[model samples]
Target: MPDRLAPLTEALLAAAQKAGAEAADAMAADGRAVSVDVRGGALEQAERAEGTEIGLRVLIGRRQACVSASDTSARTIAEMAERAVAMAREAPEDPTVGLADPAEVARIWNLSALDLADPAAEPGAAALEDDARRAEAAALAVRGISQCQAASASYSRQRIFLAASNGFAGGYTRTSRSTSAVAIAGEGLGMERDWAAESRTYQSDLPSPEEIGALAGRRAAERLGARKPKTGAWPVVYDERIASGLIGHLLAAINGASVVRGSSWLRDAMGAQVLPKGLSIFENPHRPRISSSRPFDAEGLATAPRDIVRDGVLKSWTLDLGTARKLGLRSTASATRGPSSPPSPSISNIALTQGDRSREQLLETMGTGLLVTAMIGSSVNPTTGDYSRGASGFWVENGQIAHPVNECTLAGNLRDMLMRITPANDARAHLSHVVPSLLVEGLTLAGE
Candidate 1:
C-alpha cells in the first residue's frame, strides 16, 4: 500500500489545473475481503479478494466532473485528471456544487478509533476457510436446526485519503467484521427459513461463534407454526428489526438535500408533530458504540448531536455545508461521502428513544393484533407519505403469540402512523436503530 498520497495528489491537481480546472481533489482506496458459504455441514464456497482505485474530481470554475479508475500508473492518473477537467469545462455549471468548503477539512489526522494497519484483519486463505467451518458447526449444533443455506464470515479494510486544491488534506482507514447464517427449520407445513447476521467495525465487538449460531437457530424456530391471519384494521406491532428499517426510511426524509430539492415529505412539516409525543430521534455522530460514528463528517465538518425528530415533531433537517449554506440553515454535520460520490447528508448513530412499556406487556396488550416481524417490502412515496408493504409475523391473540401469518399487507399513510405509534420497552440490544417495540392503531390490514 502507498503510505504517502501527497505526490500523486499534487500531480493530479496540477494536471487538472493545467487543463483549465480551477480546483481539484483526488482520492484513492484499497481493501481486501473474504466470503464463504456452508450447506449440510460442509463448506460450499470460499474466496478472498483485494483491489484499489483512484478517483479525480475537477471543477472548471463551477461545473464539476468526476472520474475514477483502478489503474494507478502516473500516465493513467494524469490522463484521468485531464479528462475530468475537460469534462467539467463542457458540463453545465452551477454555483451550488463543488468539493466541500475548504474551511471544514479535518486538520488533525485521528486514528484513535480505527485499526488501519492491522494485518490480522485480513485473514489468510486457510484461516478464512476455517472460519466458515466453525460457523457451520455451531449452527448445526442447535437442536431442530437440520441444515443451513449458508454461513459466512468476512473481514475487510479500506485505506483512504483525499487531497484538494483548496489546501486541505486528510484520510482514514476503516475495518469491518461480518458473519451471517441462514437456517432451515421443521418440515412441510411447519417448515420455515430465517437468517441472522452480526456486523461490527471492530472484530472484537462481534459476538462469539456459538452466540451467532444460536441467534440463527432461534430465528428459524420462532417462525414455526405459520398461518394466515384474518386481516382487518387492528393495532400493529413492529419488532426491533422492522422498526429500525422503518427508521431507516425516515432518515432520507429528514436529509437536508432532499428538503432543499423539494422532494421530501418533510418539506413543510418542521415544527409539526410527526410521531407520537415523547418520541425522540437523536443523531449523534460522535457516539462511541456505533459503527457509523464519526467525529467529523465526510465533508470534514465537525459533527454534533442533532434532534432530527423530537416529541413527535420534525426538528432539524440533515445538512451538509453546501446545502446548509444554500438553504440558510446551519450545517447539521450530516455530510456523508462514498469513494466516488460527493458528500451528502447522512444521519450518524441515530436512535429513537426508548419507551416505557415492556415488550411482553406490549405484546400482551395487542390481543388480536398482528405482530409484524418482517416488512416484506417498503413501497412509499416520500412526497406523499403513502406507505403500503407486505408483512409477515405471528398473530397475537389474547395475550399470547399464536402462529405465523403470511400474505398480509400493512397499509397506512406514514403521516398518520407517525402520530399513532405506541412505543414499548426493551430498547437495548435491539437493532442498530435501538428503537423499542411499537404499537400502532388505525392502519388498514387488508385480508379476509
Candidate 2:
C-alpha cells in the first residue's frame, strides 16, 4: 500500500511545483471497509466500500489552499494542484501557515514497533452477517429482553502516506474490527434501551458476539422501570463508560485553537491549579496498537509523551506547528488532519490518573447520590465553564444502588467540579481516553 500511495503523493507534489507554488505537501489514503447489520434474526444491511483519495496543499508565501479528489488520474491531479495554487494566490496570508523545518521533521520512526495493522485476512460478508445474527440471537435469548433492536459487525483497513517538499515522506497502515448489539427491555411506553460494543486493532482480540450481546441484554434489563430521582444538591458519580466526557471537556478547554480565539475557560489558567492536588492528565502518542497512537504528526514532526496537567497544575496546551508558532511555544506534535483540510491541534491518547478505590467503594463514599451512566443534550458555556446535561442511571442510597433513574439534569461549573472529583480505578485500559469513573460532590440535580 505504501508503494501504491507513494506515487500518487509524488505526482501531487510534482504538479504543485509545476503549478507555480512556492511549497507544497501531499497526502494520499487508500481504505476498504465491510459492515453487516442484523435485525429480527435476518440480514438487514450489508455494505462494502473501497476508495483511494488524494489531497494537495499548495503554499504561495503565507497563503495556502488545499484541494482533494477521489479520482487519481494524472489530469485530475494536475487540475487539483493548479486549482489549489490559484486559490492560494487569492487567499488571505497568515504568517503561521507553512510546513515544518527540515531539521524539525521526523526522519525515522518505528512503524514495526507500532504494530498498527493486523495480519489476518479480511472477514467476508457472510461471516460478518453471521456474527451480527448471532449477537442479535444472544440478545433476544435474555429472559426479559423484549427485542433486539440491532446488531452489527464491521472491519476496516486504511493506509495513508504523507509527503512534502520539505523533504519529509512517511506512511503507515491500520486495521480495526468491531462487534456491537442494542437491546430493549419492555414494550411501548415502558421500553428502555441499552447497548454494548467493543473494537480492537486485531480481530482476535475482539470479544465474542454472544458476550457482547448478553451484556447489552443485561444492561437493558437493569434499566426497566426507571424513574426520576429526588431533586436536590447531591453528589454524582459518572460511570466509567461516560466519565471520559468529563475529562474531554477539560481537554477542549485547553485546546490551542479555543485559547487563540479567546473562547476557552482555561485560557488564563496556564500553570494554575485546575484539578485536585494528586491528579494529572498525561498524553502518550506511542503506545503500541492503540488506534490513536501515531509515530509522526500531520506536520511530519515526531510525537512523544507529555503531561497536560501535572499534580493538578495546567502544564501544557495542545499545539500544532501553527498554533505553537502563534503562541511562541514549541510544537507538541499534536497536529491532526484529514485529506481535505490543513492540520489542527488535537490530542491523541490521554490517561487521567487513576485512584486507589473501586467504583463501588467510591459510591459507598458518596452514600446517597445519582450514579450517572448516560447523558443527553449538553449546555456548556466554554467561556464560563458552566456545565449542564440531561442524565439517566441508577440512584444510590446507603452506599448501594437503590433503583434505576431517568430524566434528570446535573448542573455545575466545570472548574469547581474538576477540583472536587474523586476518581475510581475502573477505567478500561484499551481505550484512547483512559479516564476512570469520577465522583463529583455537591452538584445541583433537577428531578422529580
Candidate 3:
C-alpha cells in the first residue's frame, strides 16, 4: 500500500516545488468499508466502498492553500499542486502559517505498540448481514418491544500516509468494527425509541449482537410510561452512558481555536479549579487497541500522554501547530486533519477521575432528585458558561427511582456545574472518553 501512496505524495510535493511553492506537505489515504443494515429481520441495505484520495498543501511565503482529489493519476496530482500553489499566491499572508521545523519533526514511531489495526481477515458481507439480522431478531423477541427500527453492522479500514518537505514522512493503518440496534416500544403518542451500540478496533473485542439488541430493547421499554417531573431546583444525576457530553463541553471550551477566538467560557480559567478538588481529566493517546491511539499527529509530531486538568486545576489547552503559534506557545502535538483540510487541534483518549462510590451509592446520596438517562437539544452559551438542554430520565424519591420522567429542561451554568460534580465509579475504560455518571447539585429543572 505504501508503494502506491508514497508515489502520489512524492509526486504532489515535487509538483508543488515545480509550481514555485516555498514549502509543501502532502497526505494520502487508501481506504475501504463494508456496512450492512437489517430491518424486520431482513437485510435492508448492504454497502461496500474502496478508494484512494490525495491532498496537497502548498505554502507561498506566509500564505497556504489546501486542495484534494480522489483521482491519483499523475495528471491530477500535478493539477492539484498547481491549483493549490496558485490559490496560495492569491491568499492573504498569515505569519503563523508554515511547516514544522526539521528538528521538531517526529523521525521515528512504534505503530505495533498502538495496535490500531486488526490482523484478522475482513469479515465477509454475508457475515455482517447475519450479525445485523441477529440483532434485529433479538430486539423483536423482547417482551415489550413493538419493533426493531434498525440494526447495523459495519467494518472499515484506512491506511494514511503523510509527507512534507520539512523532513517528516510517516504512515499508519486503523480498523474498526461496530454493531448497533434501535428498538421501539408503545404506540401512537406514547411511543419511545432507544438504541445501543458498541465499536472496537479489533473485531474480537466487539460485544455479541444479541446483547446489544437486548439492551436497546430494555431501554426503550423502560421509557414507555415516562412523564415530566415537578418544576423546581434539584440535584441531577447524569447516567454513565450520557455523562460524557458534560466532559465534552469542557474539552471544547479549552480547545485552542475557541480560546484563541476568546469565545470559550473557560478562556480565563487557566490554572483555576474546574472540577472538584479531587477530580482530574487526563489524556492517553498511545493506549493499545483504542480507536484514537496514534503514533504521531497529522503534522508528523510525536504524540504523548498529557494532562488537560490536574487535581481539579486547568492545566493546558489542546493545540495544533497553527493555534500554538498563534498563542505564542509550542505545539502540543494535538493536530488532526482530513484529506481536504489543514491541521487543527483535536483530542484523543480522555479519562476523568472516578469516585469511590458506585452509581447506586450516588443515587442514595441524592435522596430526591432527577436521574437523567437521555438528553436532546441544547442552549449552551459558550461565552458565559450558561447551559440549558432538553432532558429525559427517572425521578428519585427517598433514595429510590420512583418513575421515568421526560420532556423536561435542565438549566445551570457550566462553571458552577463542574465545580460541584461528584463522579460515580462506573466509567467504561474502552471508550474514547471514559467519564462516569456525574451528580451535580442545585440545578433548576423545568417540568410539569
Number of the top-ranking candidate, with lDDT as the measure: 2
Candidate 3 residue lDDT tens string, 4-121: 8887888999999998899999999999999999998778999999999899999999999999999988889889988999999999998889999999999878889999999999
Runs in model 3 deviating more than 4 A are: none
Order of all candidates by TM-score, from best down to worst? 2, 3, 1
* Predicted structure 3: clash tally: 0
**How do all the candidates rank in terms of lDDT, highest first?**
2, 3, 1
Error of 2 at 99 (Å): 0.7
Give lDDT for model 3: 0.93
Could you tell me the TM-score of candidate 2? 0.99
Predicted structure 2: clash tally: 0
Q: Provide the lDDT at 91 for model 3.
A: 95
Instruction: Put down candidate 2 lDDT per residue, 1-448, tens digits, no spaces.
Output: 4489999999999999999999999999999999999999888999999999998999999999999999999999999999999999999999999999999999988987888899999999999999999899889999789999999999999999999999999999999999999999998888999999999998998999999999999999999999999999999999999999999999999989998889999999999999999999999988888899899999999999999999999999999989898899989999988888999999999999999999999999999999999999999999999999999999999999999999999999999999999999999998999999999999999999
Candidate 3 clash pair list: none
**Candidates 1 and 2, the one with greater TM-score:** 2
**Each prediction's whole-model lDDT (CA):** 0.75, 0.95, 0.93
Off by over 4 Å in 2: none
- Residue 269 lDDT in candidate 1: 87
For candidate 1, write residues 114-204 as lDDT tens digits.
3333434465656655666666677777777777778887777777767788777666666777788888888766788777788776667
- Indicate the TM-score of model 1: 0.92
